[model samples]
Target chain A: MKIKSLTMILLAGTLAACSGTEEKPVDQNTPLPEVETVEDEAITAIPDDVDDGNAIDGGSDDLSFLEILDDPTSPLSNTTVYFGFDQHDVSGEYAPTLDAHAAFLMEHADLQVVLEGYADERGTPEYNLALGEKRAIAVRDYLQVLGVSANQIEMVSYGEENPVAEGHNEAAWAQNRRVKLAYSGR
Target chain B: MIRVNVFFILVVLCGFNAAVVKADLTFVVTDYVEDAIPIAVVPFQWKGKGQLPGDMAKVIDSDLSRSGQFKSMSRNKMSSKPHSPSDVQFAQWKRQGMDYLVIGSITPKEASRYSIRFYLYDVIKKTQVAAYTLPIHRRVFRKAAHRISDIIYQKITGEKGAFDTRIAYVTVEKRKKRRLYRLKIADSDGHNPKTMITKSNSILSPAWSPKGDKIAYVSFETRRPRIYIQEVATGKRTRLPSFKGINSAPSWSPDGRKLAVVLSYGKNPDIYIYDLRSRKFKRITRHYGIDTEPTWTPDGKSIVFTSDRGGSPQIYEVAATGGRAKRVSFEGSYNARPRVSPDSRKIVMVHRDRGSKKFQISVLDRETRSTLVLTSGALDESPSFSPNGRMIIYSTAGTRSRNILAAVSIDGLVHQRLAVQRGSVREPAWSPFSRR
Candidate 1:
């Protein structure tokens, strides 16, 4: 175990340098030029009620905007987004709900939400944990694309440990494999 | 009269379950080899002042039977209780269709110490094959019995016995609305069980130190998974620094100086080694795909882990220090949680059979690269090999679906299940040979 530690130190430095250079090309190729246009469009597209930042008199207060989360009929009420087995893709079915959440986060900068990813009790625990994280990160990326600040989104994964349904059937598994959009400090 | 009185009390306390005696736990061989060697272990005569520290003969019988190597003769059929070769009951045992006989006596010597004399006899040859007198502590009398079984087993099978080792496992129980998780350690025969930690959260992936004095396990008490190493005897634990993401799947090096763990503080779950002496952490695998469940090779030169870099999860091996990983499994679409045998000649993992769509424990020969499925359960996983590499203990969930711990011989000849009435037990990690 000791014989290779010295070489490993050098390898890590080289790998870090390699990753640093790889990111530069992608940042220069895309996303930089459109950042201004996307932000301006997102600001103009905000709802009239949330456009006003006043909290008192039932205006665009942080609490008033959060009321959208509590409304049963609102798209923000859909806290869970289900995924196929071993998949992290955000399907089209959840696009509207996620878009609602992205718009809400853009409207309320103080609102911080945690995306807790989970998997069913099937694969190995460690692998499931990675899969769960992948699901959360995929949602995080989608929110980022919608102009939601990355700092407002916290990602966590419970893997298959915290199952909502205890049954081993497909119905229970489907319910358990999901990403829960848990809002805090509401 | 005294022996009869004590025996009666034990029988009643055991609820008339003749198959089990009053030990912390008892093992029943659910299956065994068809032509196992039959042997008779006479109840050890107690010439001491008080009752014998433990039923030594019963332990030996259970240890040997659990090994899938011997079929112990029922004690009720014994024609005589012999304490030494001079008792001369070989002819009677041979007539009972037994190949060997064991006899012993426990006599007190000094304060908290006793002299245990035992002899192994070849009934068919009518000769005593092995005999020894061991001075044992009253507290470790059961361990002495295991050591005696080990000696006798080595004499009979020419392979060192792992009966004196230990196993660490996690048990989960639902109480009201909360689930209780406990990290526990017990003897190889499921005796002297000690719970190291109990919490409302979860504990998983327990790895024993090379010396069997410390254990490394992942605890979710802090709300996120983090690795902790605790001294088994002292119960003192040191939780490693939690990174931004997961800090799980800890495995100890053969020299006990470092641990190979899976850390996802980066963008992906990767392998890292934490130095115990220097308190330094080094990254081993750098991949975008999932890389976890790191296990050290027997030589400690390389670590075999589960990686999905090639698309799906499979076993891979890389140097103990950071390096490129080489794929190790190819027969299955899914194989993960790889554990190497004591000799590093075989690897066991949770294998998903493509045809049946069932997950079972599968063994792969490192040399031959041939895969053999060792279990039939729908969900069999967390396989750990015995110190002697003769048996594997794993967790299995059946159709009715309550997870439990089970052990099978490497050859799949014998099988046994270990569980309590309630609670689910999983992740059985066989400890190395006992230091004492």
Candidate 2:
């Protein structure tokens, strides 16, 4: 029963997926500069008291912003950013994925998230702790560049203590080195 | 809420709950010096009935053998057993090419007390070099055995022994989908495991105070890392104020007056000395880069730490009161988390050779400015000096992907592993010599 509950907790994110967002980049592989103007409607979400009641299309055919994040295929569902060994810089490939989260966090001004960072089992935990924070900050800086509020984000590092994959191989390590976005109050 | 459980996989051991004795850890001597001193520690005679509380002589023998300096003779190989110097079998032991022989007896005393007596003889010289009778309660018979080993070790080697000391380490286990972390203390030989603290989150950097009475470590109880000083005996802990950012890699000063803590006030982590009595913190370094893993010198003069101010991560020396830092390690691109020797002349640290992915334990002689890589593991880290500065106990990957604690003599001639049945052990901190 306990095992089932923990699995359920982990899969909660994926199960929240349902449909697509309103302002997703037309070309998922488009350059990051073009991705900036993709969220032009985010101006309406700037106010602190913004609510989900202002759906762009309350029509029977349209999905809400939260519903788009709930969609498994939506870019907002890609909350984790993977990194190379000992490297903390966010690469170009993660632009679209992070851009989508940045848009959602801006729309829901009340939502807060903890960016939990981690490292593989190669280096010392102390250095890895520092490295983990750097990775999380990399993700946070990207969000801030897209105009996400500082109060809407928090950061924590687990270093090499917690593992989503329990192995010493490259495949497992590739999964361990990550900065995950944990949304509060789903 | 979307909370991805990000974690690094470590150690695979199949040690499920099973029937066992008190000792949760055991020693397996992997490499022994080919020409170690031939010593015979005969099984001490037990006078009381219903079996002795513990095997006193065996503990002493294991302690000696673990040092990699003595090669103990097996009990079965001995022709006869003697309890005192009067049983002169010096000729027989010399025939077996034994240089030293230790004999002892455990006799019941009044009110649950036991009179433990031991005799150490130089078999080559045919003379009894040392003998002592310890009046110890049966409850402390195991500790008495370690005390006996210390006595014999000091008499022959002329160096203070660390057999009576303890080691603090952190172990993590996967309970279904949850990770359980534990802070454990054990005998120097990795026996009699005792848990000082346990939590569901990560616990990093368990460092022993100079006096060995208490320890400071990092725990993530509130889902954020913070430092806590814990009393080993009482389990009482006081958490340092939760700063804005990371508070970790705590090292107690030599005099046990202050602590060197790595604190990041939402900026780069820097070393700060937190005074215990005044509860005031003084920033020790002003740098825009990472400055952490600060360890004080035995003389309490300078604090050596790992920093990347120069470029790559390397060991640097700075004044305890704050000053311009000088680099200490130059042999490798990666050198951090240095633990100084008892003599204050040598430092053991984790080193990654140039153009290499593996991290091994290496010793740097500050006077000569030379480095010697010890263990040849793919990833050997958390190098801690034994109290006598003869051995280094560190964490290394074990067989089947399990991370276990291993010890190597300073010269790298002898090696041993503290085998655990389950859980991945890391960040092992060998305690200072005990006052007892």
Candidate 3:
């Protein structure tokens, strides 16, 4: 009976050790798969603009610098996109700008764009940072739906740290809450 | 004629019932010590032609109760509502076991102008202990009530009251498509908010000078965030030196000669002290990562700021002349906004847990290096202490999608919300003690 009791204790210790080791390895390894799934879902959500190849083949390689600058229909031109107060949701009026930018991205596959998100100064600095990030991500997601590659675009949230207007009135606030599209690389 | 007499008798009964209802307005102070001094706040007599708008007695009652020093009795047990010290019957209050009785009356001085005369009496001694009169307009009746509370508080505790001071905070209101930014200055108890600065551009980090004559804050008015100092008494402002890169996090020195701020004009953000007397800026910290949120020690010899030069953000202190910064907080992964207490012995900062999920306001004992968490909320930041170092005011969010300014005693016992509406209010900077 004593020998049997000793064997039982030894088996319990080994099982405990095995369980502890198993948990440590699994905990360390599980986050990568979860991240991969999130990324995969994001990729699948991309729009048909990139798949159709109509968005990137429009810009001519033979155009001179002055002609490119003078082109009124160039997607490379700057445009203003508006967002709601304390929110990063793309407004209904600004959807067309994203669509145009997506078309530009499809036409110029070599050109990279950066989305700069800003908030009106009203909330805490840290919260504004997060809000700005949300605004930039929202715009990026919409552009992705238009078939723009996620890798070709970068997003940065300036929060309320940058503003285009100085007035405290409604007009100024509307101007301050925006995401600007800037071309980074040719 | 007989019907008229019957009507008069019914009117008299109704008047008596109204008087009884008015008598129910008494003040009680709870949460006191074992041998707390018993005080009573009598029903504030209306001096206006119309009925009183708000409960003045209740405001005074709660203000004194939250101090944790006085024991106020219930109004139901009061003998009478005396308009002044002469009208008070000392024997009645003495019989009810009240050591002190407060009597006050409001008298209309002019059109919508009123003066509140209040008296504190020692019932046992049968003599008036204190008497004062405050003249106020109809719009400031609540402030007069708080002023009366301050008087009573000072008489009993021998410490000056903070009721008359003001607090400056940032208020964010979202319109249909734009976010509005407003810098509001309100009474210390969060009443009578007046907008000092309003802009669509974001404003943050308001710091009051030691003299309380001017305020320094960060504004994004010029397309980029820059520090601006505005005079409180006069509507004058002065912009600080704007460099090429980042300009944020402004803190005033104790003597008001230099302003400690963070500037990333070079490579990375570092602490810089701008001397007001010389009008010259000097970089105090040279670090690779972010070193911001500079707060001066009371003595003006050292500065305590947040720096991630140690891998993660932690509280560090360096000489005003700038040298090696010694890390003060070691337990938390994130500790920022280090506000030194009035006595300069304790440091209050926002501390984040290991995973950075929960952020709380904590007090670090400088002597022992032991930390005490003062708040348990999900996110509580920007803690500024009252001038006397007895209480701290910080911002926290509750049930709704709004930020609320809250205050608690340094010991974390007394807690109260400052805002009345459901809008977001944050970055509370407490004013210095009133000069009198």
Candidate 4:
């Protein structure tokens, strides 16, 4: 049985490596298949509790909060939060999304997330790195005030090194100054 | 009518006589429109050396040639090689159309030590213009050549020369997998490069202090870039107050008692002053936009920095105490890296011409409000004035992959290129006047 399991792991590694040619070199040394399997099991078990528990009676029967989160048409899945240039202070307009994300974090205590901060490409590279860090810290502080555990979140600052928009115009600058939240672990 | 006719004829006759006498005694004033001095540097004779010293004559020849004030004759055209002014045949040099000649001899003084005596002779005057003997180690033959150039320049132009000075630059070289950045100190002609700091991170913005004993540069060693002052002679380094956020762009005050830098430990990037005597950092500018690249005026009374607070990057001057800043550059859309002249009456900066899409060195006369363009090269940055404030050393690149050091006079007449074998030589900070 152990030999069979080892063969399955090797097959999974081969499939992951074949996904992207640029990422194949990094995948060869990383144990990504094992981590993926654990994540898959956790995601599959979350829906079973939502189907039979208070989530069914807490809202419309057919359109539960969990159902809205999973549906692509729902506003919760399409929400995008904006931050000020070189600032992480949740603007008054973004407070509603912050409250929603805070409720989501409270409902799923086991979910670990990472907040990545970025800056526009105006200042020096060194100064921008520190600015991005402060932006991420500001967002993390707001989330913590909303009762998210500090241990469940990680912060990283990419500075001006990476940009979502490549243009040097004002529209691109506004879009590049942002913090992105991504689920990292179960 | 008859009297008027007589008067006109008399005047014409007198004017004709005067013209004839003036034509006969006319003296051609060649000195008023003289060209650059044409010189020939003969190879030095070794007196007491086991292995003859390096070609000191070639070093001196290149040094003088790069000044754009002398035309060096080819060695093959020389009629004879001389060791001193006495050995030089002035008629032979004059026949070759050379105006001046330089002769020298090297003798071994002791172990690894040598003495060089050289003489500069004017062929036209048939006399020795200057003579000097330099005692130095064998490895310093190039330096001896630089000192000779300085002596000859002072004798010719009545101004202190910059050949003997040194420049501190940041060198970036790639190793196997990582890029190695170093702060290097070398002669102004790019010789004897000594790596002061070698790390895997990027190092930028090297500024020499007033005394030329220490240098301030920004290094990314702690994963975040910070400023550090290092003594060039002793390699002793001290980190400045990094505060809580970002600290960089350190420019030393003329008095050397304080450093003007940009700190964003506050919410926005602003200019700050750090007192070296009291070890206290004070915020100087409270702005929402970026205020960086601080440079002190020669008198230490004011500071000039680049800021986008005016809706674009422009040069602004603020009092050392720091309240309100007045806009100094109104012509260029992008004018950064403002280096005030030693005389404190002008500023040399990198000015971007938006229409032509070129960045060149420009001089701004604070008194006249006039701007003069200095270079036609594309992508010219980092304009640093020589100690005399007559010339500027900047970095420019062509189709080549790396940037090269270029010098241009303030009047836009003298232009020359410094030859450095290394690729990508940038951010040249000219040292202050050397006491030695």
Stretches of model 1 off by over 4 angstroms after superposition = A1-64, B1-26, B398-400
lDDT per prediction? 0.78, 0.79, 0.68, 0.67
Error of 3 at B307 (Å): 1.0
Per-model chain B TM-scores are: 0.93, 0.94, 0.82, 0.85
Q: Which candidate achieves the best TM-score against the true structure?
A: 1
Give the lowest summed-lDDT range of ten residues in model 4 chain B: B1-10
- In the range B1-436, model 2's lDDT, one tens digit per residue, is 1122222111111221232135656777777777778999988888888655666777888888877778789889999888867886889999999999999888898899998888999999988889899999866666788889999999999998889989999887879888788999988866668999889988989999888999999988766778889999899988865454588999999999999998765456778888888676677776766788899999988899998777678999988887678898999888988989999999999998899888899999999989999989988999999899999999999877778999988888777877786988888999888886
- Please say which candidate is ahead in TM-score: 3 or 4: 4
Better of 2 and 3 by lDDT: 2
Tens digits of lDDT, candidate 1, B240-359: 755545778999999999999887752578787888876666778777778999999999999999988888889999888666689989998889999999889999898986666677
- Evaluate model 1 with DockQ and give the value: 0.11
| Tens-digit lDDT string for candidate 3 (A1-186) | 434433443443343334221211223333322111112221121122221111222123443432342356764354668876655568787766678778877776645566777777543353344455557677888988989976456555566554688554468778888888766423
Q: After superposition, how far is residue B270 of candidate 4 from its true place, in Å?
A: 1.9
Query: With candidate 3 superimposed using the best TM-score fit, by how many Å does residue B288's alpha carbon deviate from the native?
Result: 1.1
Residue-level error in angstroms, candidate 2, position B54:
2.9
Candidate 2 has what TM-score?
A: 0.85
Instruction: Count clashing residue pairs in model 4.
Output: 0
